[model samples]
Target chain A: GAGVSQSPSNKVTEKGKDVELRCDPISGHTALYWYRQRLGQGLEFLIYFQGNSAPDKSGLPSDRFSAERTGESVSTLTIQRTQQEDSAVYLCASSLARVPYNEQFFGPGTRLTVL
Target chain B: AQSVAQPEDQVNVAEGNPLTVKCTYSVSGNPYLFWYVQYPNRGLQFLLKYITGDNLVKGSYGFEAEFNKSQTSFHLKKPSALVSDSALYFCAVKRDDKIIFGKGTRLHILP
Candidate 1:
C-alpha cells in the first residue's frame, strides 16, 4: 500500500506570498495531520482532521495558517502572507483513527522556503 | 499543557554496543508514549508505542522501549547498536486528540 504523499517536494517563494501544500493520505485513513519542522528542530503540530468531525485547529501557530480536508482523503495546508519564519519542511501524516493509539504514517514532506 | 522532553541533543555509541535514548513526558492522565525514527533524507517512521499492558514494548529494527510510570519516562533502548540505526529520534506523547513530540535526539553509531 502506498504511504502518505505530499506534492511539490520543494517550494521557494517570496515573503508575503501565499503557498498551498498538498497531502494525500492512505486510501482508508480517517485521520490526517500536518506538522512543521524547522531546521534542526522538532515537529510542530499544525492541524488535524478526523472523519466527519470538526477539524482540530488548536495547533495552528497563527491566523495565517489554516488547513482543510475533504472527507478522509486529501488535505491542504495554506500559509497566507508567508514570512521567513515560516520556512520549514511541512510534513503530513495519517492513521487508522485517533483512538486506541494508532501510530501515524508520515509523508516525505514539502520543504517550503520563503525568500 | 502536555509536553515531552529528550534531555540529550545527541548520543554517540560504538557499533555492537548497547544504546539508550532517554525520553520523559508530562501529562494530566495516563500517557500514550511513542518512539519514531527519521533517517537522513527520509520521513519519520514509527518505532513502537506504549499504550498499556507490559512495561517493555518491542518495536522495529530490534528496538524496544520501557515504560516507567513512576518516573514518567519511556526510554528507547537496543541491546546492540547498528550503524544503520544512526538517525534522529523523536519522543512523543498523545494528549487528548493531538500528539506532542520532543525536540528529538540525534544518534550516531561509530562503526
Candidate 2:
C-alpha cells in the first residue's frame, strides 16, 4: 500500500509570497494532520482534520497559515505572505481517526525556504 | 498544555553497545507515549507506543521503550546499537486528539 505523499518536495520562495503545499493521505484515512519542523527543532503541530468535525486550528501559528482538506483524501497547507521565519519542512500525516492511539503515517514533506 | 522534552540534543554510542534516547512528557490525562525515527531526507516512521499494559514496549528494528509513569519518561532503547540506526529520534504524546512531539534527539552510532 502507498504511504502518505506530499508534492513540491522543495520550494524556495521570496518573502511575502504565498505557497501552497499538497498532501495525499492513504486511502480511507479519516484523520489528517499538518506539522512544521524547523531546522534542528521538533515537530510543531499546525492543524488537524478528523472526519466531518470542525478542524482544530488552535495549533496554527498565525493568520498566515491555513489548511484545507477536500473530503478525507487530499489536504493543502497554505502560507500567505510567507516570512523567513516560516522556512522549514512541512510534513503531512494521516491515521484512522476512530481508533485510539493509532500511529500516524507521514509524508516525505515539502521543504520551504524563504529568501 | 501537553508537551514533550528531549533533554539531550545529541547522543553518540559505539556499535554493539546499548543505546538510550531519553524523553519526558506532560499531559493532562493518562499519557499515550510514542516513539518515532526519522532518517535523513525522510519522513517520520513509527517505532513503538505505550498506551497501557507492560511498561516495556518493543518496536521495529529491535528497538524498545520503557514507560515510567512516576518519572513521566519514555526512553527509547536498544541492546545492541547499529551504525544504520543513526538518525533523529522523536518522542511524542497524544492528547485531546492532538499529538505533540518533543525536540528530537539525534542518535549517532559510531562503528
Candidate 3:
C-alpha cells in the first residue's frame, strides 16, 4: 500500500508570504497529524484530525498556522505571513484509528524555507 | 504539560555491541509510549510501542524497548548493533489526542 504522501517536496518562499502544504493520508486512515521539525531539532506537534471530531489545534504555535482536513483523507497545513522562524520540514502522519496504541505512518515531509 | 525527553543527544557504540537509548516521559494517566527511527533522507518509521501488558516490547530491525513504570522510562535497546542502525531515534508519548516527541537521540555504530 502507498504510504502517506506530501506535496511539493521542497518550497522556498519570501518572508511574509503564505504557503500551503498538502498531505494525503493512507486510504483508510482516520487519524492524521502534522508536525514541524526545525534544523537539528525534534518533531513539534502542529495539529491533528481524527474522523469527524473537532481537530486538535492546541499544538499550533501561533495564529498564523492553521490546518484543515476535508474528511479523513487529505489535509492541508497553511502558514500565513511566514517568518524565517517557520522554516522547517513539515511532516504528516496517519494511523488506522485514533487509538493511542496504533503506530503512525509518516510521509517524506515538505521542507519549507522562508527567506 | 505532557512531554518526552531523551537525556542523551548522541550515543556511539561499536558494531555487534549492545546499545541503549534512554527515554523518559511525563504525562497524566497511563502512558502510551512509542519509539520511531529516521534514517538519513527518509521519513520516520515506527519501531515499536508499549501500550500495556508485558514490560518488554519487541519491534522492527531487532529492536526492543522496556517499559518501566516505576522509573517513568521506556528505554530503547538492542542486543547487537549494526551500522545501518545508526540514525535518529525519537521517543514519544501519547497525550490526550496528540503524540509528543522528544528531541531525538543520534545513534552512531562504529565499525
What DockQ do you compute for every candidate structure?
0.77, 0.73, 0.86
lDDT of 2 by residue, B18-79 (tens): 99999999887788989999998789999999999999999999999999989989999999
Q: Global lDDT for candidate 1?
A: 0.95
lDDT of each: 0.95, 0.93, 0.96
* Candidate 1 error regions (>4 Å): none
User: Compared with the true structure, what per-residue lDDT tens digits does model 3 show for residues B47-98?
Assistant: 9999989999999999999999999999999999999999999999988778
**Shift of residue A64 alpha carbon in model 3, Å:** 1.0
Please write out the lDDT profile of model 3 over residues A1-115, one tens digit for every residue: 8999999899999999999999999999999999999999999999899999999899899999999999888999999999999999999999999858689999999999999
Compared with the real two-chain complex, what DockQ does model 2 have? 0.73
Off by over 4 Å in 3: none
Each candidate's iRMS in angstroms? 1.2, 1.6, 0.9
lDDT for each residue of candidate 1 in B6-87, tens digit (9 for 90 to 100):
9999999999999999999998798899999999999999999999999999999999999999999999999999999999
TM-score of chain A of each: 0.97, 0.97, 0.98
Query: Of the candidates shown, which would achieve the greatest DockQ relative to the real structure?
Result: 3
Write one digit per residue (lDDT tens) for candidate 2, span A26-90.
99999999999999999999999999888999889999999999999899999999999999999
